[model samples]
Target: MTDLPDDLTRFLAGVAPFENHPDAIAPAARAIEIRYLREGQAARPDSGTTFPEDPWSLYIVRSGAVALCDSDGRVLERRGEGELFGHPIRFGQQAAPYTVQAVEDCLLWQLSAVAVRALAERVPELEAFLSSDPGARLRRVEALRTRRERLADLGLRSPVSIGPDAPVAEAAARMAEHQVSCLPVVVDDRIVGILTDRDLRGRVVAVRLDPDSPVEAVMTTEPVCVDQELKIEAALVEMIRRGIHHMPVLADGRLAGVVSAGDLMRTQSPHPLRLVRDLARASDADAVARIARSGPALLAGLVEAGTDVTQLGRMAGLITDATTRRLIELAEAELGPAPVRYAWLAFGSQARLEQGLISDQDNGLLLDDALDADGEAWFLELAERVCNGLDAAGYVFCPGGVMAKGRWRMTRHRWRETFSGWMAEPDPKSVMHCSIFFDLRAVHGDVELAESLRRDVLEQARSSEIFRRFLAAGSVTHRPPIGVFRQFVQETGGDASKGLNLKKRGVIPIVDLARVHALEGALPEVHSEERLRAAAKAEVITERDADDLVHALRFIADIRLRHQVERLRAGEKPDHLVAPDALSGLHRRYLRSAFGIVREAQQALAQRYVL
Candidate 1:
């Protein structure tokens, strides 16, 4: 053992395990301690080691394959030579939480916890790569997360296909059964043509071809085929450029599967509007309610799938709003007789379209104020009924008591007067109202209603310096939670105390800033992220800044969605509290980078506006 020098011992202590890539103290690995495990030897369970509470370690698989099993027999993770394990332990967890068994003669570098922390502190890139899951890293490399290329990567996989000689009826039945828009016609492992729903409707039915006619007769022969090796971005461009919904995949002149337009659409978080569209077409309120219950599922799915936070919020809002709109439609149909011209003003997320899975109803009504006192009183009654109906339909009532049911939010003239008063003085509350009301997209009735209010508010806000101050101040409320002492600020209390709430901290900061930019730059868009990008193009914000914010927002949203999905899978309510342990190594690294971007953007925004 080479004298076991003091510096060397200290370094080994730092790099004890996978979680401890960076040594905790200032020292370098003079030499790593190597141990070879012969076949049939169980590598020490990471849980077995304890010292100084450094809690960081990395088991370097230097020369053999090792399989990790949970207390249960299920495989948790696997590593071969050059791979490492034990990252889950660094987050203060003691248990290796997984058991390891040598599958072959193995050599390992026993990295100490202290050494790993030190290395992580100094080498950010190494920290990110070493901390991330190998599978996720590989996917990122192959799919390209920063842009639109991932679509093609999915589309060119093995396609659902049938033999060309098969009856058109059979192919059509398969398409309907699978809910796919098209089926590729294959002959001897080569895709010769594609039979789409459109083709069946137009060529088969319109032409009165027999249902049992050969699919080849109705198929779009020699359909555009994308090479499996082609970049996803290029495939997307080609698919869009060609105006084709279904593209056949070919690998080495052999048929791979088919990719549909739906396949081309990069898998996105559960979009509220998509859900609303589904709800609108539904047969009854029970179905609408059932779909509405899926809000948490949608939120979690987006987070799990890695959808950007800002986009996820927007999509979330769209679904919530859509549900509200449908519920309102159903309620109104039952109630009958408008009795007056009015705007069903949706406040909060319905107004902003950036709702979370768990949010309450914040709505108001704006009437023309032309009704008599008795009529007006009756209108308030109607408003309460509508709000209550929406609540029964699944939207909980706002705890803060912001709803059309509240008489303060029911008057039409009061709404206009309220904005006017706010414009006249522009105090903190007034500014807050502006921020919330500014997002109102007007879910139902009188399209011109919300627009009139918006135009007046914009005109007032564009000129009022006080309003800008209030807006800027409100926008700066949520700071990115990245710690100054370290890359990320792990929560330190409660169940979610250690895990970052990406929504409130990371996503909201950028969203609010983007909203401020939109208002100040007089951008027409209401969604904060969208407004930011538009403002950038209009020179209100630099394009680079906008891109960074968008990218960071998207990445964080993806994290939030994934976390939510994991919770859903566990049969827990989808929430912002994601266990740091649940994250793949790559995600944690991306989160760190995402936090950095958010911090930089926030600093810049502060310098430009609040500071």
Candidate 2:
């Protein structure tokens, strides 16, 4: 321990993947060897190379330069001494995929494969850095293997255009010939409008607008556009938010090309903004309903795009909430005004922005206190009509009828009174309601009013140790599935060997723990990951522990999204059920390690909550 370098020791801490391995530390430190690249011994592109079975080397350039090259003499990437390389070859590859050449005299750390493995066993950080999917591997062998460079090769082509003044018939013909769904309408070299197939169906065809009329008359006047140099992720987020069918990609001042939702869907870019745009464009409850149903599909795309799980859940929830609100808005327009001023509160998954492909409506209303018997009658009727409308459109009613129509959940003052009573003397039932209602987020109407109630509840919760205890007890009720004998516990039922409900067991524990922490700390943040981080920063939880929880949640969320995609492709419904056999050997190991992080977080939560 005295001989070990501080850099090596510091790097080993909080490495979740290999944290539990008994021999994880010493072997890593002992096996690493440092060597200097000879002054003139420069390797080059297409240079002949020696093959080794497992003398895996960690090449850290100490000085000068090095180039990663392919057999065709193509220079792949250039690297400096402070950077590490050769990760791809570490897993027992007989030959390196690309040759590494010394551009000048250099000092290198040639950590042996045996040492790397030993280090991985000892250092969770090293193990995670080394153990990545071969197909998905793109670690820094050189600085040039960047996403920006990869996107350039994707080569978005220049888009075809038409003048807004051009006849609709001519524009339609051009669109048909090009076999594209959209065209940018330009006027005097400036883009003025955009036209899409949906617009054609909804407006032109439905209204029987003459095709011979000017395209400008029917074209969407304000088109959503993105700068060509913007990252694909940014662009996708924009598209989702705006609910546009096409985005005109502009480079400098010129139109480069167009990107559509279909193009993005096919590529599986983790652009939640695009989904937002799709939701925005939804014209009716039925159309919005269909688009809302694609939440899991969008989530899968986000996972494939390598989105962080925190962001993934946040985006997913936002989309779902938006759709639900849209349905409510449409219903209000169709039916009539609510009997009084009311705040529609989305409960459970929708409130948390955690809805799956198939989710039931879990919403209730907060009505103004002016209501008497007549007002009550009006609200009851309104709730029934809106919920029925939502059901007809797609969302199934909550089996327990937790909607606004419920007599127990109808009035705003009653809700406040209920919270006050629960806080006065916390019980199991009170704690359960807090668990559900604490996660409440207002989706539509008088948001400030909904927030006022939340503010009141948090105020009462902050001072009550008993209330916090009940909340913590409820949170720890669902234990992580780590086994008594082995480090992990797998399924033993019909789907035994298939993955357990990662959400229910691993992720939700963290979520619930975070929720408890938030309530105890009196934090107002609604997102679970945010609540956890905020709690940690406020000294309610440790920084190291928070980091573990965040990473574990992201890893598990990534796995869940991938499995959801597989199910969707197989024409099966997306689910929390994951088949372990479907996972690759590497992924299986990752999944196991990821869950271990969850276990640690849960244990920490239990200790802190006094559960």
What TM-score goes with each of the models? 0.58, 0.60
Predicted structure 2: lDDT: 0.66
Worst 10 residues of 2 by lDDT: 135-144
Cand. 2 TM to true fold: 0.60
lDDT of 1 by residue, 1-611 (tens): 34556744443443322234344323444335677888767777455542223485666665778776666655544566545665652221123456677778898776677666666665544543543333232234224443443433563444678888899899988988777788888888877788898999999889889999888888898889877776443454355334466777777787767766566454443444356557777555677778878767766664555444444565566666666666667666766766777777776555655666666787777776676686676667666666765676568887867777775444456776787788778777876667667776676677687678777777777787677877787777777676542245666676768677777787777777787888787666876667877999999888877776766766676667666676678887667766555765556656655666666666666676656
- Top TM-score prediction, candidate number: 2
Task: Count clashing residue pairs per candidate.
Answer: 59, 21
The parts of candidate 1 lying over 4 Å away from their true place are 1-278, 281-287, 298-315, 374-378, 407-412, 490-498
Query: Per-residue lDDT of 426-452 in model 2, one digit per residue for the tens?
Result: 888887777778888877788888988
Candidate 2 runs further than 4 Å off = 1-126, 129-284, 298-302, 305-308, 356-358, 392-394, 491-498
Deviation from native of the Cα of residue 115 in model 1, angstroms: 19
